[model samples]
Target: MSEENTPTSKSTDINERHRVRMERKKEIVDDKIQQAQRKAGVIVITTGNGKGKSSSGFGMVIRAMGNDMKVGVVQFIKGAMSTGEEKFLHRFPDEVSIHAMGEGYTWNTQNRERDMEKAEAAWAKSKEYLSDPSIGLVLLDELNIALKYHYLDVHKVIADLQARPPMQHVVITGRGALPELIAVADTVTEMQEVKHAFKSGIGAQAGVEW
Candidate 1:
């Protein structure tokens, strides 16, 4: 080609450099986003004497639901009692699946057999939810205490959860979590009891303690 007809060398070099730099940056950003998505299927377990374990799990459920994700909740000990959160969530029952064991806690029930029965039923429901790939998140509320008290088989629970779909997430909450469960969990949070009005002779308040 004639020198006058050929493209300017300086402009051509600058354009090639800009294209290379943009391609490299795009590749790096794509890789980082893929890594973040791969690590998304995590299990969060919270156990301690303090409150908010179940509350925190339900908060995640609410967030997922808001994002148009399906969520399942199995309350092991808490009965079908009317709590503020439950009452509020009941409005959108289609987005959330709640299976509450009709019986209350062992401390309140005072019946070992009944408590075990309730826990077993709730565990069965949780197992079904864990197996469902459509469920983006499963909240097993008060499951740790059920495991601590030998209400459900911990090994079976772990096996079922580990076998779930790669993108599914799980959250277990309650006091006295087993070490084996913690070892398998991706994130663990311990809420220590620092102070409480209950010890000060104040009764449990609605929408706060319930």
Candidate 2:
């Protein structure tokens, strides 16, 4: 075979082409990173039919805590049962403030008045965190569910969220995030459910669900 068609030569050519491609990709990525220079806290909404809304929100809380930032969390429609995140976060009382105010999910509670009262109470607690400049991240876990059910006024919620300290981040997690909330959110993530273990006759296991 000719030298140009030899295996070593072909390999070198392939590597050269790949290197050029990656270099071009790197430039585009770097430019985008350069454009993202503003350093302000943001409103992040994680909503969908899939799992991980609360899980993802808690992940941010953990990330913030790792950076030595104080975190405050309020869970709506999920206080009826003990969750892994709640148990773990409770250990660090000084760095984290977590409150589970809901008695249970709406369908299980079946009491609109009680659910509404719980939601209002939870929002009141969340506002305390939002107003505090010391709290770097505030996680309003499952707040979207309450907003969807109209347990709390969406406008009032937005106003409180908007009025938070300019450098404090907020995360709202649940399904059916309202359009108004989405409109004001700095980042909106909608998890798409493809396959679920629950659909395959698997019960919720600790550390995976709840």
Candidate 3:
């Protein structure tokens, strides 16, 4: 047909439209990037009754380590089993400090006094990490569980979290995160449990569920 109506011309027109759309998107995204000028560490909470909450926290720990930042981790209710993250990060002792302070899950431990004692001990360790300016990221693994069961005072936990160094990032992970905690955090992510393997016949898998 005519040169203007050729198949190649139609393809060229589509490409031009796509390029124009992307150009606008790039400008909008660049403007947003520019608007976010303030730089500081933030409190992040990953909560809800789903998997990957702690995994996501560990992912950020790895990210911090990749950036050459020192990381500290305290397991609140997960010392019953050796997690995959703990095993892997143990090799990088210089970069990541791990403290599995939990006495085990609450149901298994079945002692409120012991659980409270362990929670307090864990918080004591966490305060050290929070106070140290050298640690760039601190992960309080399953901390929400302890807070939920009133093993530790939520108000005090939040106060300590707030008192951390301005440049020290924190990640708290577990189900039933307190509303007070969420209110103070800079970022919050709730994992929705659509399905779980334990609900079926499958058991927790190493590297995948640990």
- Give the top-scoring candidate (TM-score): 2
- The best candidate by lDDT is 2
Name the 10 consecutive residues with the lowest summed lDDT in model 2. 98-107
Tens digit of lDDT per residue, candidate 3, span 6-46? 99999999999999999999999999999998888899999
lDDT tens readout by residue for model 2, 86-156: 99999999999988984878899899998999899898899899999999999999999999999999999
TM-score of every model versus the real structure: 0.80, 0.96, 0.92
Clashing residue pairs in candidate 1 are: none
C-alpha-based local distance difference test score of model 3: 0.93
Each candidate's clash count: 0, 0, 0
Of 1 and 3, which scores higher on TM-score? 3
Which residues of candidate 2, in runs, are more than 4 Å off? none
Off by over 4 Å in 1: 1-37
Better of 1 and 3 by lDDT: 3
